[model samples]
Target: MYQVIPPCMELRDHVSHFWFASWTAQQDRVQPVYYQTASCLAELAFAFRSSELVFASVQGHSPHAARYNAGGFLSIFGVSVFAYSLPLLFDVPPAALSGRFCTPEQLLGREGALLVEQVAGEADLPARVRCLNDFLKLRLRKAAEGDHRIIAAARQVMKPEVKFDLSAFAGECCLSPKQFERRFSACTGFSPKLFDRVSRFEYLLNNHRRFTTLTQAALASGYYDQSHFIRDFKQFAGCSPQRFFALSGY
Candidate 1:
């Protein structure tokens, strides 16, 4: 079973949501390989049964291939971290975390190491949730004045019908082209082009039910045509679109 909750109003700018899942060990529990593409966000995930807390960062800073992994059993609680909000969550910089997973203890020092044991000892999911929220709320800070505009521009590029023009958009933001590119990369971990590509792939992967056919899904996700869609699918998913959809458990 699983549950998901949006971050509180104060955290809406930095966090996407808080989610938890529980599983029972069984001889026949279904285990499947998952082909995951990159994202513009990072996540802190905890697997209580195994006493594991990991920071997952598949932020597509480069055009890398897909990441493959398998899942088994556990009780897990996770918070999705936004690209620009990394500093507010941790003293670490966002650029350092691209395309890798780090244990919280490795990233946060002794305080982080203690969090694993502390949050895991909570009596129930609600207790766990409160524990996590209290910890994060203490670290909150006001977003930088420029961050508001940068993040707003980034959001415009991810719209279903994206109409992005590098020079024009930069001018609109009152920044020179190079200045815009630099700030955009600093705010999001990737160049604007790579982020748009991976984000489109992420959108269709997560929102498969929004369309009934490949063409509909491709076009709605801002792809120019089927051929380009297939190319990115193979690049990020490590398989043809057909097999990606044909898998028994995703």
Candidate 2:
């Protein structure tokens, strides 16, 4: 089974969640599913900070193919970039990125695709992820810091029963409205408003379960009203909050 190291406080800024798993050749199996890749002796990593689709491919075969099944995973989440790798997209209408689903052999930077396994048994997954995350953090720190800053700002801006304004947000980012929109898209692969909306929805879904009332869930998640919440929920999750709650069985 895949096991994930818990997040260190500093690294948690960009990582929504992290987990790792290893299986014998016979045990490492995958179900046909959308947005999920497979592995053997594999490590899976992801980052969901801003809307930007930053992810990595340290080792492993592509989910779309069955060669060099040794196992490792590094993928980004966002709108399809259409590179040789599978371009998983996250946006207004989030969809898995698509591509030839290339393997480690095709990597431009050899270490980039081979490091996941080299460190697997190193006695510290969380520390390793956090250390590596430092690199990603520095990248964000240098590359406008807009990605991390925006997500952090959005979290603060969200409130129950209140709708966030995009124009005001643009002003706060110190960019003209038009410039903000362009920069937001370039960094996150989606507009600021849309990214915030989806993020709120994801937060709600993660917290909801069998006993969580629809009204309570909506309220806590920043829905202005039940109807408003339902509209957004259906659009993002492909089901109403009620249905999702029932299916959750939590």
Per-residue C-alpha lDDT of model 2 across residues 84-180, encoded as one tens digit per residue: 1111111211122221232332442464454443333234545556545554345334443235445544444434345677688777777778877
TM-score computed on alpha carbons, candidate 1: 0.83
Error of 2 at 26 (Å): 13
TM-score of each: 0.83, 0.55
lDDT of 1 by residue, 1-250 (tens): 7788888887887787888866666567567343555576677777655555333222323345565544643666878777667766776666778776777777778867777777767777778778777777777754233466777888877776877788887887899999988988887777878777877887787676777887888888888998999998888777888887786234
Error of 2 at 84 (Å): 22
Off by over 4 Å in 2: 1-6, 20-108, 119-162, 209-212, 245-250
Q: Model 2 clash tally?
A: 16
What is the lDDT for 11 in model 1? 81
Residue 41 lDDT in candidate 1 = 69
Question: Could you tell me how far off, in angstroms, the CA of residue 26 lies in candidate 1 after the best superposition?
Answer: 5.3
Evaluate residue 113 in candidate 1 and report its C-alpha lDDT on the 0 to 100 scale.
79
